[model samples]
Target chain A: MPSSSSSSAPTPAAPSKMYADDVSVVVVLLDANPFFWSSAASPLPFSSFLSHVLPFLNSVLLMNQMNQLVVIATGRNYCDYIYDSSAPTNRKTGNGKMTALSCDLVAKLEEFVVKDEKLGKGESNGAVMSSLLSGSLSMALCFIQRIFRSGTFHPHPRILCLHGSPDGPEQYVAIMNAIFSAQRSMVPIDSCYIGALNSAFLQQASYITGGVYLKPQLMDGLLQYLTTVFATDLHSRAFLQLPKSVGVDFRASCFCHKKTIDMGYICSVCISIFCKHHKKCLTCGSVFGQAQSDAASETNKRKTIRT
Target chain B: MPEVRIVARNFMDMVASLPAMKLDQLYQNAFICQAIVRSLPPLAKKYVIQMLYVEEVVPGKLIEEWVLPDGSTKYRVAIDRLVQLRIFSETFDRTSGTSYRLNPTFRVNLQKHITIGGVLPREPMSATITVRLPSLEDLEVYAHEQWECFLLQLINSAQSERMTNISPAMMRIFQRGLLTQREKDAPRLTESGFQFLLMDTNAQLWYIIREYILNSEELDIDSADLIAFLLELSFHATGEAYNMNTLDEIQRITIKDLADLGLVKLQQGRKDSWFIPTKLATNLSVSLTDSSARKEGFIVVETNFRMYAYSTSKLHCEILRLFSRIEYQLPNLIVGAITKESLYSAFENGITAEQIVSFLQQNAHPRVAERIPSVPENVTDQIRLWEADLNRVEMTPAHFYDEFPSRDVFEAACDFARECGGLLWEDSKKMRLAVKTEVHMQMREHLRGQR
Candidate 1:
């Protein structure tokens, strides 16, 4: 139903007009969170991870000559566009474009990781930091928007988040904003959580955007999971059996405490969540008294029941 | 649209039609394997990639479980296509049930292509030797001009302004399907040729390419090698000049033929010669179903049925003349209208209304292409109605049986013909019945048996 609504909305540049000829544009958000991958408990090494990912990238390009790929490395505090297939290459390498692309991607990713590590060392001694997923998502959305605006033919654009980092509770609002933007644009946000635990934020993002979200049981078979589940273009996904979402965690993080809560007090004017009652809304600065709060809570209770 | 679909299938179908040994041999080349994978159905491509590294045979049930219940139709189609192309080798076992494993050659080659990467046979020539080479835009223009010239030669050799130096061998390829010649008359466009003219450029290119490959044996060329080279050529960067000396004997000849089709542009320097692949050459490996890969549309059709084409090429004018009356032409634009008489003429030439309408829609100007119906509904409807007017009367070849010995015999014959689903007409009073020509022999035998 979301697909139908998004397609029928008459958006200026809707990617919903997918023909067999239309090429897929996948924006890959690679989690370069050094803290997560370098941890002793991590199942796959960073080097082996690249070995798996490079083939997956090649396979995506091999699926269609015109299929476009954009790789973004999401580090602790920043995300950078590392490799773009559409970027014109001036160097005439003896090898094919596929080889050139893989080489460039690995080089760029190494450079990004080195810079991020240096920055992280300066900022915090050895503290764990969440991958800048929200920033990467926003960047991916912006890049897709630019492609849509400069349209010759509308390409099917989707964001592929390959990360193991757990969700950052503080960045809840920004991540949700990116999710809704992706939903509105009908760009599925497929998430392949390579981490040890399930990412609730990504689960909700994939659920909302009608994308496949999978956490492979065996980390060694990451390439298989990516090729079988994530490599499928939007049009072909209609016929494939993708991993189904059992249930989404709809819990909201309170605006004040930045702690995720199942049952929360809603701000009357701004709809901001709070762990406890407040006289004024923190988000919109709208004043609310006891009666107004009671009414808002009553409506929120009904909405919760309906959902 | 059906013609377009046929064109899409022609190249892959040719690949599928190859003998198994040759196909396996062809798969030895990593680029050809990659090309085959690229041309697979979307679901099939996923299956190949999923099983690329897995050495064990997968149960058919496991692959089936990958699709939803509603997607079983697609699942079957995907599996069938894979099997047809020999990408998946199926085996039946008593205990394991049916299982499939990737073809070893295809898997190994594709894996190498993905992991180690494929190297082109020839590297692009240095800029110093190929000084003052054409820019990408110039190469595109040259390719377009060459293709237009070739098509014009197809339409009418004498009418083409430039002497199309297409070799007799190339002309022979077109002759087999598109053109027909009388004893002493100039070769003329056949029914399919007229329809071919209306097809999108990519489809037309595929048709010609398929014909060329089909006729490769006559030229003592192995089609598998030809296909491998063609697919490899597509992997090369467009407008980059590759040294001709690096090619083998068969490839050198094939490149010459491809140059004639404007797939690649040939360039000569003071010391050496090389071939620069144009967009057409680069598009060769692109799956035929990728209609968007074709050039941008240029024809704009209004509700009034007036047409405007913004192409300077004479080929566009000739193709438009097939289905519309060209009122006038400017340096860069042509004005035309779809009239009843022109439609009739087109229909007579075996061009269908749907073909004309689809041609308009496919080549619609970018300004109107975004609309829901690229071609106006009224115009399409009128075109269909005009075609229907020509097809109002039904014609059938039948054998009339009369003067039967008795009413019962005639009634029995009528029932027999009706049962066969070939009864064209029957009249119990006259004791006469007409059966389709195909059923006449059966009817005669049935009557004798009755006797």
Candidate 2:
């Protein structure tokens, strides 16, 4: 028996071969972290990250004719829209308004970070995760709706990047909600923690959204990472090696204390989450007021039986 | 057959979810469409972006002023194409309307794209170094193999070859509707089968996968899963292995077929612990401009109709033999001639002249490809003439009309037929006409009452 393997190295029959010719939509979530950017001006600064990211963005533009890119800046206040090459008005501005807008948005994000860090002391990193998630997501949904509504068919092969940390629980919840929404929309989320000190939310965002999550060790070589791994558009990535994330932190933050934990108690009435020690749920106002007393009595009965 | 139609309709329903535009209208009206499509200039994309957010019609004159005088025509053409494509919406503003604003969708995306200086960087991906998962390679391989197997099934079933190397489950799927099984286990190929074989790899793959997707619904596979898997497969690189455990159940079953077609290699048994994706699998979603695909071009054609293929693989020889009359084969070169007999033989074998010509044109030798006309015009003309010769019996099955109410009625029917491209023959003297399609029959009936 030839055993199938030895039957003359299978020839790549032209007519019988499969070819890649798809358009992938890449949504890059620009971190609105003016705090980390302001704190560091050197090796791992915002400028450094941009220098790394822009080329990868260009590579995606070069990947396929149908490929589209969406940029959303997550910052304080409203999340600003940065870019989407597929949109009609963005393609024809004679005055370079889109570029101006992007520069302005990034600048604004930086300015907010600087202002927030100078005014407040600690734990107030001006990272507005909600705005970023909401803004980028709204744009993506709009684009998708346009695709679905237009009589001519448009295939959406997608890659989404959440680039920084969530500011707090609200931002975390919003980002999580966005991840689920993206999942429902069939958009895969790929996330990067460029200068995130504690971005457990983004890590979960990536995990839930079927996106690749990366935390770079050598922060300076950000571009190399983007190009080699993320730069591979949905089509090109098929033929090129890609890096995969390992050991994701699946922990969630409790709604009561807003602490990241592996296990937590849930309120039966309103589905409010709590990390041990609360008789009544703060979010839902559900009462298990006598739970501690009941537990003590049960333990006392067990002691009596043993005696 | 009805079952197949149902499958096809469901598949189309999924495709219906995407954005749509009439290509003809898009090219004629939108300038931005032309610019982005032909890669005119960075300024064109910029112009489109600026106009997207604004709700006013920027006058054509203002557009002229916005762009440099020398590049005015380019910008105009770009705008024209975009408007034609409906990607850009044009409206005449009644109040101080000097220019056109960009459409909302285009404006939003373009603003976002150009802002970060044209798309956000894909760098510093989350899974960088220190601890990268090893199973991605397996997933990549599994994806490739699954796709290739589908292609091979198309070929083997068409040829009716006794190749059991492919899995039985895949065979059943092919038999089901993905591929129309041969009447017998004979070595002959049918018309549809041969036509499938003559198409370019890209088109062929699309056809097979489309068929596979249509058939997947019957297999209890979610259409979304198929679409996602197909899209995801496009992201894996050739020669790399991916974790098999990462694949969904339907995909796990599909990978076996891919390995059989040389699209990928399976490391172990039914579970397939690790698999390596081949070039075919990795390039499944890539467009022609992709450098890796361009680099793989091995066939070189000559204007004199002499052909030389650089591949030593038997597969190349087999494909070449489909049209070319092979003279001899060497370690690295296979010499062939494009004779009239060979062309007719190919036509008889269900190959079209266009396919043969395109195949040669696509794989033209690097030397010839650099020329202004990749393949000599004479050779192209010859191929077409040969195919034309075979189609000498010009005939169309049509409905005839002899009795007409008046010349006007007959003329009206004739005009409608001409517009529909269905008029085969006509005689104004007898008030008679012949239309080559049934669609015109109803059209003629509608014209009768009006006349």
Specify the highest-lDDT model's number. 1
TM-score: model 2, chain A: 0.69
In model 1, state the lDDT of residue A259.
Answer: 88
* Each candidate's clash count: 0, 99
Give per-residue CA lDDT, model 1, range A193-221, as digits (tens). 87776788898788778787888888788
DockQ of predicted model 2:
0.04
Candidate 1: segments with Cα more than 4 A from true spot: A1-18, A90-98, A118-122, A290-307, B5-8, B127-130, B184-186, B301-305, B369-382, B392-451
Off by over 4 Å in 2: A1-307, B1-153, B157-203, B236-241, B261-264, B268-272, B276-282, B288-292, B295-307, B367-381, B396-451
Q: Considering only the true interface residues, what is the Cα RMSD of candidate 1 after superposition?
A: 3.1
Q: Give one digit per residue, the lDDT tens place, for model 2 in B1-451.
A: 0011223222223343433442322233222222232232233344443353456566767766644466666667667655643456677666645455565554444434433333211121123223333365555555444544454544453433335365566556554432345767544444455555544454445555666666777877865556545544544544445667767677877776556655556665344366556656655544222212233457666778888888765555766776779999999989998888888887886667777777777676776666767777888899999999988997778888788877877887888888887888899998888887666667757685675
lDDT of each: 0.81, 0.55
| CAPRI class assigned to model 1 | acceptable
